[model samples]
Target chain A: MSEFFQQIINGLSLGSIYALIALGYTMVYGILKLINFAHGEVFMLGAYSGYFLASALGVERYSASGQSFPLGLALVVLLGAMALSALLGVTIEALAYRPVRSAPRLTPLITAIGASLFLQNAAVLLFTPNPRPYPPILREVRFTLGGVIVTNIKLAIFVVAIVLMIGLHQFVQRTWTGRAMRAVSMNMDAARLMGIDVNATIRATFAIGSALAAAGGILFGLDQITINPLMGVLTGLKAFVAAVLGGIGNIPGAVVGGLLIGLAEQLTAGYLSPDYRDAITFLILVVILVLKPEGLLGVVRQEKV
Target chain B: MTLVGRRWFCIAGAALLASFSACKKPGGGAAPGGSGSVTTNESSGLIVGHYASLTGNTAHFGQDTDKAVRMAVDDANASGGVLGKPVKLTTLDDRGDTAEAASAVTRLIDVEHVNALIGEVASSLSLAGGRIAQRRGIPMISPSSTNPKVTQVGDYIFRVCFIDPFQGKVMATFARNTLKLDEVAILKDVKNDYSIGLADTFKASFTALGGKIALEQSYSAGDTDFSAQVTAIKATKAQALYVPGYYSEVGAIARTARRLGLKVPLLGGDGWDAPELFSIGGDALNGSYYSNHFAPDGASPKGKAFMAAFKQKYGTEPTGLGMLGYDAAALLFDAVKRAGKLDGAAIRDALAQTKGFEGVAGTITMDKDRNPEKAAAILKIVDGKAKYEATVGP
Candidate 1:
């Protein structure tokens, strides 16, 4: 029972990170009806940017007594990564998606793939091909809840993910821009007719989603304490699965889907062979899709001509 | 009446001119001894090429090997070069792709005019490259690939590392005799030739050594969850488990196996040498052991010197892969120096005649097939660190 609870906590912690990243995917898909394959790469770039920021700020540099400086560097790194990632996201959508906005829908999908590959390889060229070592900031701190051991950093990550997710939900459901986004998503022609800038709304959606992914990526790096050029590939795939599993164009569904997938993966790994962990994740996704094609929280919308 | 005859004459003249020009080949220069402009010694300068995965998943291995070769070549050149006229080293990146590896070897032989070659970190890639080298009669040495059939292709194929057979025997002997385990379950990686080869050999050796094989299961690479397989293994009442694969899968497996309450001792091969294994596996990997060519701590004077220099250069202790790369480079240089000439045949003979040559790993002597017959060391993981346990003789 103790082991079970521990595994659950592990699952929840991982799921929360995935959920944050998936929200971005779901939000972008909702507004644009296009999968931002490069969103995952944006997450990777954010992790690297955070890493550089942390190092530049001497977060890991030991003092004379072997103690690190306590200057809120982690927060600084987070803000820096978020800002840079949002900029990159806006640029990607503007250049890649904007040009093909009126073209065939398949064109943007292909361009997204091209952008993804470009970012991945360009990262390889820009950074060292080898994995970078990420030094931990909050060491020797642990919190035990119901026999499940977790560190302060992990708790911070979970707290931040939930807070950001709730903030995003509020922003989407209550804010003026949020209504504009929903208007655009529901009927782009009507939204444009009603004096809404569909293009700007789409760009805004991408920026928000990308920022969330960036935050998730930073947290993931903090969790794993390593960064690699291809780190985003698996994360991106998982986020995509999370989006699809929750219903691609549904925002809340993406959140629930990400957490469910994360739990399923962790629980499977804890109970079964680690080799089947990824296979089981995919298998569960298939099962869910078969049982409920509309997803756990997805609203099946009727297409109105 | 005369027009038809004139046209036929002109067409015949054009045909004769075209055939005359086609008969003479272009750039037909320098037939052997044609210029007699051979003032320089042509029989001694040898060019050795390397084909490695330098730009993909396993690029680190190739990059390290390339660095080692460069270091060795620099040292050799400083000492008056191989076979007198400095040895030239060229490289091709296979990108960890087999098709690319094959074509890279073809290019190395045809375009680079290399006399000998070394490379390929993985078995499948090595085998693919080895076939081309063998058909073309080029002597190619693999630095890290350990599958048994890697050298079985032909006389020209060889490896600096121990084969899977010996590694499997080492693991089996340790499990049966040291661990005193009678029933063991096996987990193999299906997609990797290296993993499958070692697992099959370990199974054969384990069952032969008075150990009962409990169950055997397989998993493909890049798989992260193994709950179904772990549950099956747990039900088997086995005392130990053998997981033969790379570090990535092994780390996740070790963690999951413990979580499933099936904490049997796990055994593996050299692929478990990555730094990520300990962090990912954490305390789950304690008491596990793997077979490798060399351990940095258990070093002879030469090995110590090499380790010191490597640490001085790289700020970290060199792993077995790094040492093997260094040794392979040194061995090739020694052959080049002994031949005192760069001719392909002379260098091949020099390599074939290598005997009692000492490397940082161990003493190496090439057999008729050019494969090194050397002992292997068993390293134990205690407290997330690898310690040399014992050495198995040849």
Candidate 2:
């Protein structure tokens, strides 16, 4: 029973990060119908940026009197990561996607992949091509809930994720920009016909998605306390799976998909061979795509032949 | 004039082509060279190529190895250069992805036209990279890849690190004889050939020494929860658990095992040498034991010297990986000096002939398998530090 509950905690924590990253994928896909393959690289940049800022603050290197900002320091790192990641996302979209928007879909797809590789390699050149130990910020204290020992960090991640999801849901449902985004996603031509300023909406989608991914990246580093230049690859793949499973362009679908994938992975590791965890997650994704091509929550649109 | 779209088309074409060209300008390096290939030109200024897990999860090890290699190259160049020709090191990031490693290796051999290669701290990456060198007749020396299959890629592939057979035997011996364990279970990282090789060897050796193999399970590289594996192992009546994998997964496994009320003695190989293991496992791994190439707590004078130098350079006591890399670099330099040429084949012959070559790890002698036949030390975890236990024969 304890083991069962423990797995749930682990699943929820892992799911939260995936959900955060998936939001970026879903939002961008919703607006542009393009998978921002470089979005993962953007998350990688955020983690690396956080590492640099945190290291500069002397958090890890602190001995006796070195500069340390436990609370304010975390905030600064988070804000800096979001800012840098958002800027990178916007610049990449402008340089790589905006011009090719009208070109064949294959063109931008290949470009996004190329951009992803470029950013990944460039990061390796700029930073140490190594995993920097994420300086431990929050101390772990296990508390028993229903006989399950849960770490404070895991609980905090869950709470923070829930808050962020709620905040996002409200933003998309209540704001004027949200309606514009919906219109743009529904039909770019129609949105433009209605004076929706489609270009600006697309840019905003990229920015917001990148920011959320940055947050997820930061939280992931905080949880594991280790950051590597290529950490984003696996996480990105998993989040993409989540986004697709929940319906690529649906916001709520992304959240549901993230949690489902995370829980599935944890349960597999908890009950079966941990080696097959990722394999199983990917297999399920293939299965879902084959069975429900439109995704679990996605609306099936009829072709206007 | 409705010609505004044409301007956009030209701009997009130029930008897209620029990015594509940048990516395609450099292909992956060549295959591993054979013992008689003259692939490098010393007179033209040597290009030392390195293919490592430069951009992924295992990038930390590759980065540390790279730093040590650069340091060695700089030091060698400062000392009148290698044979009056300055050494230039070119690196390719494998991203800790296997396919990427093959491309990186190809580019290093074919495009960079490197004289000799040093790389791939991870056993899997090295195995993949080694094949490229072996197929191309290039000399590729791995600093710390411990999987036995790494050297089997070809005679051109060599590692300064001891193979899993020796390390695995050392761990098994420690568990059966030193820890007095009658029964043991093993958890290995399935995605990694190194972990699987080491675990298999340990199981074979442990079972041979009157110890029962209670249960053997597997996990991938990034798995965080181990409740089911632990639960299954708990029912097996095992007295010890052998987990051969990197520190990331091993630390999580250790903590999860403790939480499951299984206090058996845990054992592992050198992959548990990362500093993060201590932070993640904490009190969980207090009584665990692992076999490593070099123990930071070694009483040997050479070990002390290397530790001191490492501290001076990195401001932290070198992990076994760092020390192994330093030794590999120093050994490679020795072979290069003895071969008296920048030719890949000549240097490989020199490497094969190495005997009584002293290093921080120990005296490394390449066997016929192109693996270093040297002793490894057993480390016992005490208060988040790996303290020396006993040095066992190779």
Candidate 3:
């Protein structure tokens, strides 16, 4: 019972990161109808940028004393990472996707893959193929709640993730730009006819999505305390699966799907064989796809010929 | 416009022909010295080849080994090269992949005609390269690959580090006698042969010593999450935890285990030795113990000199991998001098008959199987630094 509760806490924290990353995939797919496979690399860059920013700010000097939560420095690093990642996301879109937008859909998909590979290798060349230990922004502190140990880092991750999700929801629902984004997602031609700037809407989607992924990356680094160039490959793939399982392009569904995947993975690892964790996660995806076709929250749409 | 195009096409054709001719000459030069042949220059320099994971996930291992090998070569040349012939070492990066390791060995044997081979810090990569060297009857020595199957490839294959069975026994003895921990949990990397082999040996030895394994869990390499495993282990009443995996996963495991409030000391094998370990595991790994090939904190006079020289050259203390690499190269060079020739068969015979060759890591005596018989060092992490605890012998 204690083990069960402990795993739930772990699952939620892990799921929050997945949800943050899944939002990027869902938002870009919602607006551009493109998978944005290179978003993982954007997340990786964000982690690296945060690492550099923290190092430059001398976070390690204070971290040695086991100080809990260098909140000001951490926030500065987080924002810097998000801003840089947004710029990089836009540049990647302009250089790789925009040129091939009019080409066949497969062409842009291939370009996204190409861009991902290029960025991974580029990072390797620039940083050397070694895992850098992430500076501890929060001191290690844990307290047992009914026999389940909960760390302050975990709580911080949960709070920050929920806050970001809420902020994004309110922005998309209450702002004029948010309405324009929804309009473009619904019907790009119609939205253009309604005096909406489709290009700006697409760019805005990339920027917002990239910024969210950057936040996820930094949080992941802080929690795991390790960052590497290829860290994003498997993680990105899993988050993509999470988005699809929640009905890709659906905002709330992505979060729900992320939590489900995370819970499933933790429960499987806790109860069954640890080796079967990844296999079981993917198995759930297969079963859901076969049974529902559209995700748990996905709506059926009629096509007019 | 037609005339101009024709003239440019003629020039391009001529340039292509010239480049092809230039490339063909080196190809022809390499053919005469193929298949177990030794390539010696006019200066009587013997060609030797090395391959390791210099640019992949395990690049730290390769980079350290490569540095030590270079230092060894420089020392050998300065003190009158092997068998009075200046040794020329050619190293290729295998990128930590088995296929790449095999091809690199092939290139060394077929193209460079190296008299002997060295390298492959990882056991899987060593097995791949060792098979080729064995079939070709070229002597190959590994610096730190401890899996027994590596040398089982053939007699021509050898390693300077003690095999996993002995290392596992050493740790088991330490846990039972030194640390006096009775019940332990085992966390192993299923994908790694080294981890699996070490875990099996440790479990067997520990159980034989009347210590019980309270829990056992497995994870694949490159996994970042160990929460479920840690939670499960936390539920157990185990007194200690044994994590037989590389530093990459072990560091993360240590952090996760500590975060979950499992305060028992963690134990591991030589795979835990790397600079990144401290950085990744941080204070979480304080008080953990691991068995290694060599410990710099308790060095002999000769070992101290080697450490001083290494620090002077590389600006850091030599790691176990680096020390083992120096031993491997030094052992190979000693065998070459004893053989008194650059012949492959002669070197193999000398290496087989090696008895008590003192190396920077330890004194290595090659048994009939070409595996070194030596002692292992136990180190404890205190205040984020590895302090030498004791040396356990087989």
Candidate 4:
């Protein structure tokens, strides 16, 4: 059915953003052995940074005046936002996570939650909780494929998400930093014994993960056209569910999990009842947890000792 | 490691304490209930309490309502204050949290010893704060919270705005008559009492008026994305979409609906009356229309004066919620003046007997149910502005 195709497109578009956000949670867990709860705030900061940077570069002014912003400028803003978000992610690592790193596993997790609440409130204090128009990067252009309608923003989100996922895959599989990350994930002390700077590796993982989340945030802003301080809370939790569903430490699993959650949410909203969208998403999680406690892609590894 | 954790915990504790102390509480100077300053037995000053969501999700409603109430206080003071006693308003921030709203009202009643209460531009919050006012035998007036059950707390609580059924029927009637739309889709919010109630009433009235609901959908309160709901609506051949949700999600919904090529204009209720609606919804919401208490395009002379004064002070156009706030506060003052004293029972009696009071929103008369029998405004969004289309009177 056309509605079925439309729902799939909707699901995939939403899922791509979820995938991007989930990748951050997955990588950080992989590297630090701690779920970075503040990663969602980092994504939120990414959206803000992009908005501020675009305004700084007169792109927002152009959009406000009903003029179309250049695509090249949009890309530049996206990269700039990602870079700023990376620096913020690194700062969060140093200030919030690092101090609590060696204390206990639970300590960093608690600190991450604290940092998340702090950042969420700080955003409200700074941005004033007013949902601002995410300055348009592209004029809304719609294309109907058969009976299903697709917007340029939706297509762009899907394309960029897939491209970024592939690039991350290649980078992780081929790069020396990836090897260092893997070594660190294998055993922190063992990685340090093997002359790998575990801290730097963890920071790099955070930076990459944060950059991915930034991309997600910008795309999400472009599609929604509304950005607010508290937008990250529910979204961050959903992405975390995606990461856990796909095996928290598994990269490809995060993307698949994101897509599945997105599809489940949309399909449920489209065909079933809209109210049950979240219920279904969580139900799938519970079912997945019950069946495969280790996650879809997660391996049951022996203790490193 | 334990020492390090303890040291970090101490630092975190110090930081938390520093922030709490450094943060200024909004209109919060009074001590606890049992404190020495608990009773305001002196009749020289009339203290009225107001609790509002001054800093959270619905802060716009709270802040705007507070502005109008403050202006009303100034007006009353200039015209020989309520019963010759200088009226002082003690406002407390609920932070848009229901628990905070209850505690704030508790503090106002027990600690400040206010004569009356005015506040909480949200229905759920007014419910939280109103229960305390009702139990404590204080008269409370909610500016814009329109849920029928808000006043059902007790006889002591009242609302200036038309209730949810009236708003829903007004929109349904306007849709059938003014817009000439036969089939409309309904997207309700399951978690919100206001949205769900309005949607149900609208559905009932629309069907009664020979209009069919082509589709029905529901979502939660704070959902940022409505792509799924909108896509589902797009599958239907509905002429219009009725979304009686708040502006925060409505704006995004409109954008998503428009982006997905759903050309039918969205219809909404009072929850769509925020400045952010224009900015976030933009050109996508141009053809949409919404129902409200006040529309600036066609205002009464009194309404025009209030609008001008409000614009002069706040530097922005006053929404219907602000107008409702002004009316609520002025009505309270008038009731107190008629009562000839700051006594709660006397003021409540006067408020119950209020009739033909000329308010900026409308000529309001308190009905038997402690609600103002008033007209609702239908405003169509045209080129980034809400233009008055028509008004449906009770």
Candidate with maximal lDDT? 4
CA shift at B174, candidate 3, in angstroms?
A: 1.3
Per-residue CA lDDT of model 1 for B167-272, tens digit only, reads 9998999889988999999989888999989988898999899898898877776554454466567768799889888776687778667655677888888888
How high is the TM-score of chain B in model 4? 0.93
Ranking by DockQ: 4, 3, 2, 1
lDDT of 4 by residue, B1-394 (tens): 4686687678667767754543235454332233226555445456778888777767888889888888898888877777776677777878788999999889888877889999878888999999989998999999999899899999999988899999999999999988889999999888888888799899999999999999999888777778888888888889999999988788889888887778999999999999878777878898899999989978999999999999998899888999999999999998988888788899899999999999998998989999989888999999988999998989
**DockQ-superior candidate, 1 or 4:** 4
Q: What DockQ, between 0 and 1, does each candidate earn?
A: 0.05, 0.25, 0.45, 0.61
**Each model's TM-score, in the order given?**
0.80, 0.77, 0.93, 0.95
**Best-to-worst lDDT order:** 4, 3, 2, 1
Flag regions of model 2 displaced more than 4 Å.
A49-80, A104-107, A189-195, B1-145, B150-161, B182-185, B210-215, B221-241, B247-266, B274-287, B299-373
| Candidate 1 lDDT by residue in tens digits, A186-206 | 989999999998888988898
lDDT of 3 by residue, B335-371 (tens): 9889887778888999999998989988889998899
Candidate 2 per-residue lDDT, tens place, A78-131, comes to 788888888888988887889899998888889899788877866765675545
lDDT of 2 by residue, B286-393 (tens): 988998888877746886886787679788777788777777777877888898887788888998998989887788888888887888899898887789999998
Top model number, DockQ: 4
lDDT of 1 at B155: 72
Q: Is candidate 1 or candidate 3 better by lDDT?
A: 3
lDDT of 4 at B362: 90
Give the per-residue Cα lDDT of candidate 3 at B96.
Answer: 86
- Per-chain TM-score of chain A in candidate 2 equals 0.94
Candidate 3, pairs of clashing residues: none
Per-prediction CA RMSD (Å): 11.0, 6.2, 5.5, 2.8
Each candidate structure's count of clashing pairs: 19, 25, 0, 0
